[model samples]
Target: MVIADLFKKTEITVKNIELGEVETLNELTPEQLQLIEKGLQTVGFELLDDKRKQIVQKIKTIIIEIVQNQSKILQKINPSVYIAESIGRDYKYLTTLFSEVEGTTIEQFFIHQKIEKVKELLVYDEYTLSQIADMMYYSSVQHLSMQFKKITGLTPSHFKELKANKRISINQL
Candidate 1:
């Protein structure tokens, strides 16, 4: 059987591959699959064993969906209940699994994601810091600035001045 077939039989789904370009897991060569698996291993987080890796991927998918749909809204709308129901597991179970595997809570992961989004907005230079803060659900501009500084080691204004490449590809994080 093909390497991709092995992955499929193991219920592993590759993420972010383009549509119409080898849609099924069964299309990859053994070497390609090995390389992909190695890359995941090198990511330096213990929560990436086969089962936890799937759970992490699922959480990432849900976060991305929520961000895309609610980009304009500031407050945290409790994650849609549909997400937990759709995942076929209790939210508490998934969250505990995530924290145990990732060494951080899911809320912290979400905050990191939001901070990354804030960096993207700062790079764009289209929105004021207040606007960015509001968009990302920060309670106030100061709150956003504090969290941004904590994460990035620079104030938002300093980041704006640098105008450096601020984008962190999701997988790289």
Candidate 2:
């Protein structure tokens, strides 16, 4: 909402404020753009103007959206293909670029995001391990348990039993 408020202060109509999306009704002047960009930077949001940076941001946005929403499309499609199609870029190229820029492989980032989602579901206590496994598109409960252990050094059940919720913020993942 900070972003929306910033635009509002500028008398700019913000139609939406999803990750990597900011819609305005009218073209902004260079000065207006500069002011907005400065405001965004002040709040840790960068206006990505470089093509490569834009593509990388899009990839992160798509991955986070899919995992956080528990998207069923992942069950029917490979993540690589989904990202490539979504970004209109080759998977290999995207992976290479992401690794170069983010210092982590795309697959690793995806796994981290999935693990964070699992942590969230576990904390909510609204679903069984089997159900969460299925919802997260894991092949089985054992697979989820193994991955959960590998990433967090704690089994899902153990993590759930902790007094403190062991969940990480999605952005921090």
Candidate 3:
């Protein structure tokens, strides 16, 4: 992986890579971190050393993974618990820091990602609205519809009918 290569190139011992994060065996010096950051920036990656930014990015990554990859089992796990476990931090701390850095609450960011996922499903036309509701962990089609309309400024059916669903990327959200 690019990140692993960056670490290896810098002689940083990598202990683990999980949940879209890398754990190093030892603390990196400021110079080493700057070198890695510059290297990553050149390659369209980032090294967020600011604590708040790191937490915010972690929150977004968790939400993106849930929305894009694990939509069917979303309701089984609480967002707060899932993020806390994934980021290895308290949920309140994560929430506060994320809101401060992102200018939106984690829940709002999550909803946006879910809406994007719904748009993708609609564009696919592989599932009915009811099926999408079930898969997306909505209590009912109406709830999903309402949320979808609130976020997209159009009803789900209307959006689907438009034949031009404008889905945003998780990174853009």
Pick the winner on TM-score between candidates 1 and 3: 3
Ranking by lDDT: 2, 3, 1
Task: Give the alpha carbon lDDT tens digit for every residue of 1-173 in model 3.
Answer: 88888888988899997655788888889898898889889889887767777778778877898888845446677888988997799998888888778788889999998899999999998999999988888889999999999999999999998865466658988
lDDT of 1 by residue, 1-173 (tens): 24344345546575434311224445666675565566445553222337666766788677765655544433524653544665788888888888887898777887788888888888888999998777777789999999999989999999888775555668989
Ranked by TM-score from best down, the candidates are 3, 2, 1
Q: C-alpha displacement of 163 in model 3, angstroms?
A: 2.1
Instruction: Estimate the TM-score of every prediction.
Output: 0.61, 0.80, 0.81
Candidate models: Cα lDDT each? 0.68, 0.91, 0.85
Evaluated against the true structure, the overall lDDT of model 2 is 0.91
Which candidate wins on TM-score? 3
**Could you tell me the lDDT of residue 99 within candidate 2?**
95
* Model 3: per-residue Cα lDDT at residue 79: 81
Model 3 is weakest, by summed lDDT over 10 consecutive residues, at: 70-79
| Candidate 1 worst ten-residue window by lDDT | 16-25
Clashes of each: 0, 0, 0
Pairs clashing in candidate 1?
none
